[model samples]
Target: MKLIAFCSTGMRVAAVAAGIAVLTGCGSLPLPDKPQRPMVYDFGPGLPAASSGPAGAPLALAQVAAPAPLEGLAVNYRLLYAGSGQQPQPYALARWSMSPAQLVSQRLRETLAAQRPVVNVGESLAALELRVDLEEFSQVFDSPGASFGLVRMRATVVAPLTRGERLLGQRTFTARQPAASNDAPGGVKALTDATDDLARQIVAWLAELPVPQGARPVAPAARP
Candidate 1:
């Protein structure tokens, strides 16, 4: 009986030792690496206040459409080598807060709202419609380090007629500004400037269109 009890106690001790060894081995194993955080950027406050233009009827602005790349929030850059074709690349660690198209639309709406009543495409009482197609929004590197922010978009204005919606006017606007640095922040700054310029141009263009009959009149100028 004594011999059997001693053997059972030995076995229990061995089992506990094995369990301790397994736990120690687990503690020594390397842990998974933590993920790195990416830098996010956004266009600063939209372009300076454009000259107040005569407001026409309420205008509806549609969501801007862009290519697959510009439609994302990634910060994209283009390398313009002498031989290589234009292939855009996104920065691995840098990104935009919102897609370029969305940013541009926001800027346009804010800038235009200062001068006239602006509404979305689905608004019930919109008198005129504005549509924009974004072609390019990228930082083009001329050489290894030199770069500029380029923006190109086509704008169309339509007015509802007795028959149907009639195309009032259409135009393409382009703006390029030299980047202050060869980094994402610089690119964002330049792009914001370009967007502001585009907004000003669009506002001017809308001002020249003849107001339709029964359209709302321009809002009274603000008191100084």
Candidate 2:
């Protein structure tokens, strides 16, 4: 009797173990983890908006007279591939795989014309050339998401190539703006603001500083 009972108990244990193994193999005993979504930036929260500035204008600091009249001014930009220098780099926006030269140039052009009083490079065929080489244009987002941007650049006005006289004194501008969001729209706004902020800085700089003589000062662009 004792032998029979012992064998029966052993057989039951073996059966249970086998059943467990089968269940596990079929994943019946192994529940899957909960499905998860990838992280993304939010457009709300600390992100700034177009109206963030006064009367829908971007944030502005100081506005002074151009050191001298860019009277004979003709503006042209390079909008080159900027390396790592500032915040919210457009390249970084796209995972640092592509270049944002065109976007940056467009933004710069629009901002200079709309925000401040500068000579038109095209209509006038002016003498001085304001050259800008963007060194860095990127954003930084570790864990808080893409919330901050930096724009590093170098600018100078060269006298007509024939003159070989670069403007003396001051001719450079830079700006940084942080973008933070828990979402997507916020990230873009932050990026936009980043661009706006930099533009304002550049405009302010150009406004206050004197332009190198470029075919004598010409009339400002006709008011639109």
Candidate 3:
């Protein structure tokens, strides 16, 4: 009986030791790598604080409108080298922080604010309203090594009436800038440059437009 008991104790100790050894080996086994996150990009910090001076006519800016594809945050591009009929495609590993329309709208407001008091729709009574329709905004590749960013938009300025609004002026603005490289980052930079140029064009257009008769007068500034 003493011999049997001793053997049983020895077996239990060996079993415990084997179990610990298996657990240690499992812990040392390598784990699968984590999936990589997609890269996100946006128009870098916009222009510095606009200088304070005599503000231009108060202008209400409506939310920019875009097609279904541009309404998403995808960084879109086209490969002309692939085929002339090729459709635009979004980069798989890169995306914009906001939809193209939203980015353009933000850019417009920032740029326009420097020349005028840009406000949201219905924010300013009897103010001229600027509405933008974004038609095309993407990077187009001319060759495997060359590409350009294209931006096309239509803008309409309208003045308020007692019951509705009367159109003051309208124009289509298009701008394009060559990509520094044939990559997503290069495309984004080019797009930004095109947008800035488009904004300047709009400013010049607005300055040339004559205020129409029968339009409501600019609203008085509210006293703080």
Candidate 4:
């Protein structure tokens, strides 16, 4: 019985020593590498100060709306050569700083502010309101080596009514700019250019629209 007791004691000591050795070795083992975060991008310093001077009457700008697929920050692309029906796919290591709709809304406001006073959607100071629906914003690839940024949107100019809204004019706009290269950086650059182009086009369209004479100021809602 004493011999057995001694053996048990010895085994325990050996086991503890082995555990200590394993722990000591772990300190020298290299730690696992950390994952790289995706690169975040946005439209570079917006359109150079508008040379045209301060804009006309205040134009109410609404937050741009987009379909579900474009509501995220992922930088998306579609392969046209692969098939006409290919769905958009996001880049693994890149993303937009914000959703495309947000980016477009911001860009539009900046560009439009150059030509006219731009206000928020609910503001009653402006007789004209501009609402935009972003339909498509993505990089399109014809082949593995070629791509371009494309932006499509529908714009509606409306007059605010005391009860609702009246549409003054509506139009669809699209802009496509060739990628500088076949990669994400190039795609972003192209997309930025396309957005700028689209903004300019919208400005031109607004110039052609006759101001609504019957536009009434939106009345503030009554508290319950």
Candidate 5:
């Protein structure tokens, strides 16, 4: 019994020593690492729906020269906004940036199509020409604590084509809009709100235009 007792003490001491040595040799295992959070950014809702509408056909020459408004009267010429000459920025998920020039052009095109005079799909059918040149298209980041949006833009109408000649009279237009910007998710609301207002202005001005008549029409065979 005495020997058994002695042997048990010896085993306990041995076990303790072995455990201490293993722990000392292994320096503590690295603590479990904390997970990192993802960087968050915002973009507008999903990309616009794919266009399922009909393809656009070319306007006939007859449509182009159909008629001319009285002298000093502005004819409602077909509209065209190609989104050309400007670079549009790519949008990221969760972040709604200002309108892309192409996007803006598209919106303008659709708006006019829905309301204004017959807008040509391209410049070929346009009679009284109104060419818009985007002079500025950029969005600056709001500095920390700033409460307003950072969007600004400038554009000029470079020409008003009347017949074979280009009319250069009063050919400039500009628009600007900013909002109570919060770095918070809702910041984008300001941009869209302001944009809506600007769009209304454009539609109103174009709606008042006089559409020309008496212009020659292209035969249906010539229509694309």
Candidate 6:
């Protein structure tokens, strides 16, 4: 009887040890980590509806071209005091919905369409063309606490020809607006305001140009 009791006690101890070992192994396993999502931003202020303007041959607006740094969707900024030679750096957590060039082109097209007839590059038939080169679009920090949004672009008007496109006129536009704050949201607002001003200037410049031969002139009633 004594031997049998002793054997039973040993089995119970072994079972308890096995259960503890299993629990310890499970506790040592690592849990899966959660992924972080980036924030996306875009230009604000709703565009106005298209208004009646002078009847004319459809003008073509090409996609704006930008340098490699501005070509990406990332929101970029410059630390002027860090080093004049340093290239602009992008915010890791914030990004634009589209590239700066694309946004500018969209804004220009919408603004122009409201003033006159405009179409995409492929739709225009021997019509006047508008090409844009985006040189700068960034939030520049003059110091650790002060900053501004800067924008610069070159606009060229081209007359389509049987053989090649002829340059009719060209101009460069630059604008800077103080940021309400030193962060991405503030930069966006300033850049948007700058773009609005630039668009207005371009429209005024186009209004002064002589109507193309095939294009109809703006009626006095349609003139803004």
Best by TM-score: 4
lDDT of 6 by residue, 111-195 (tens): 8878778876656463577778999999899898988889999998877665555567999999899999998888888888888
Candidate 3: residue pairs that collide: none
Better of 2 and 5 by lDDT: 2
Give me candidate 5's TM-score against the actual structure: 0.41
Candidate 3 lDDT over residue span 1-224, tens digit each: 99999999999999999878876876555678998777998889997766685267777888888988899988889988889625989888889999999999999888988888877776665358788999999999988889999999999888877666678888999999999989899999999999999988998898787766566634322312
Task: Please tell me which model should have the higher TM-score, number 3 or number 4.
Answer: 4
| Residues 149-212, model 1: lDDT tens digits | 9999999887755455667899999999999998788888888888888988999999998766
Q: Return the lDDT, model 5, position 137.
A: 30
Q: How accurate locally, in lDDT, is each candidate?
A: 0.80, 0.45, 0.85, 0.89, 0.37, 0.79
Candidate 6, residue 180: Cα displacement in angstroms equals: 0.6
Q: Which ranges of candidate 6 are over 4 A from the true structure?
A: 1-35, 50-57, 214-224
The list of candidate 2 runs beyond 4 A from truth reads: 1-98, 115-124, 142-146, 169-172, 182-187, 211-224
TM-score of each: 0.75, 0.45, 0.80, 0.82, 0.41, 0.76
Candidate 4 regions off by >4 Å? 1-31, 219-224
- Full-model lDDT, candidate 5: 0.37
Pick by lDDT: which candidate is best?
4
Predicted candidate 5 versus true structure: per-residue lDDT over 34-69, tens digit per residue: 876333332334234334542322111112111111
Clashes of each: 0, 28, 0, 2, 15, 0
Ranking of candidates on TM-score, top first: 4, 3, 6, 1, 2, 5
